[model samples]
Target: MLSETPRTRHRRIKENGRTDPADLHAVLAAGQVAHLGVVVDGHPMVVPTVYGHDHERIFLHGSVASRSLAGRGEVCVTVTVFDGLVLARSVFEHGVNYRSAMIYGVPRAVTDPGDLLYGLRLLTEHAAPGQWDYARRPSKKELAATRLLALPLAEASVKISDGFPDDGDGPDAALGLWAGRLPAVAAWGTPEPDPRLAAGIEPPPHIAGRAGAALHPRRPPPG
Candidate 1:
């Protein structure tokens, strides 16, 4: 576990802050999207974009002309996954169960063709397992039009909240209201065939295998 730094230090809700590197990795991996914050001219802009993470770095993808991909000096990225809802007897005590990570660093733009292709493949595979191999590879023109940014994970912060209502022993407990967690889960719906598909074509195993699979994160309880 890492100690607090000036940027990552936990001042408020110190108990909810986590500094373990593994915890940070879990949160980032579980999220399918991230918000990238950048400065354009004298203004601040944050855009929601899909992301993928390796043990060392996080990759952000978008169009080459995208305003968010101005390739500025510094950037901030955040990823969050909601696990469940914590309903307490009192409205004020109600909270959400979630895991979140914030990364701050100067993102390096990937220009080399090989590296850019690899990063794009990672991004695709992160969202859908076995997708990169099953789908058509990007053409050279498509690759040229896309932009990929890589940010180191060296400076990051992780926070997670997963617990019963904190008001268990408080005055609200006397209200005799229901209090517990309502887990949040996600699953893919049935695959819809393309309108122009050949009549005899069937779904591939890679797509069929995800039927009824749990889309929830593999994260453990709060640290």
Candidate 2:
């Protein structure tokens, strides 16, 4: 279950709040990037990074020298997927359609050799499926230079906005104006291989197969 602390509560737009822990998982699974927020020397900082998560925790990593990961205090990670734009007759009613999740927790640095490799595998697979097995694993020196943090998924807040403009039922409807959702969806393009690659080398099936697929795909139903 998702924890509902004051930090995770939806005080204003309560109607859009989601309480199900599964919703948070779905949001995280669909998105590729996350904004990691932390405080450094009494100042706030937010750094965008790639993340991976399982049923209980999220994995975030960066260079060991990165200031964003130097903080030992609380951290907030947010993932947002913009679905579209909700245009209304009135400018005041214009809004966007999106799915977002915010997680709050103190992250613990991953140090154990086995755990570090496991977390790195999750991060790599989450960003590019099948790449871990296809590419060489990280060497010892590379692993030592990296810093991975694991945060519990126990405390999170999720909100989804999928509705059309509410002004349709109000006086704004009288205006002779067009109003609808302009969806912003992302699709993968053809793969561009490295120019220095050996001749005749082609993209693998997994990489080539993603062309034209949605970046944030709908979660398939479980069997």
Candidate 3:
């Protein structure tokens, strides 16, 4: 089951390096933003952008005129969802409880009209479920102005660290300072309806119901 390649080998904190593909998907799904790293015109650039993914590929969208998005070379995309703060007895022992993924590949530009719209819909829904259905679909001019990139998940790395502070048996434990994890669960807050919306319109149920919902999967699915 190991898909370990030289580029994805876990070197430090090997135990925290995850090999389960499901873990990679979960981290990406839970995260709304990803860092896309690319080299354009012999200069390196890393940009933060929203992303969406299906079983095999990640979809990124931006302005069609964006220079970085036009680059069709090797790129590294990373997504991380922080779960908690590992507060240990000593400064050196402090760490973070998180799940992260790094995907490597040369992204393919999505230009087909139908496929472009499909990918944009998926990306929109990833951050705001039901938004695509609720709002007006993109028009021809809008579609022409957007650029979409699809990166395959064939080569990637996943890592997770979600344990109690590792200071129980260490000398720092004698310091008597508190040592435990301070969990950080992301939750949706009250939705602020757009001021320009029609007076009678209300926040749809799909968006309204997510208020205060936990973003991470606390456990594995049942059989």
lDDT of each: 0.85, 0.90, 0.85
Residue 50 alpha-carbon offset, candidate 3, angstroms: 0.8
Tens digits of per-residue lDDT, candidate 1, 1-223, equal 7545688887778788998888888887678899999998889999999977777888899999998887888898999899899999988889899988888889999999888877887798888878999889999898889899999988888889988899999888898889999989987777789999999998888788777776656854222
Q: Which is better, 2 or 3, measured by lDDT?
A: 2
TM-score, every prediction: 0.92, 0.97, 0.93
Q: How accurate is candidate 1 locally (lDDT)?
A: 0.85
Cα RMSD for predicted model 2: 1.5
Alpha-carbon shift of residue 4 in model 2 (angstroms): 0.9
Off by over 4 Å in 3: 216-223
Clashes within 3 Å, all models in order: 0, 0, 0
Q: What value of lDDT does candidate 2 attain over all alpha carbons?
A: 0.90
- Compose the digit string of candidate 3's lDDT tens values, residues 144-209: 898899998888999889898888997887888988999997888898988888898888898888
Candidate 2 lDDT tens digits, 36-115: 99999889899999988888889998999998987498999999999999999999999999999999999999999999
Q: How close is candidate 3 to the true structure, as a TM-score?
A: 0.93
Candidate 1, 159: how far from true, in Å?
Answer: 0.8
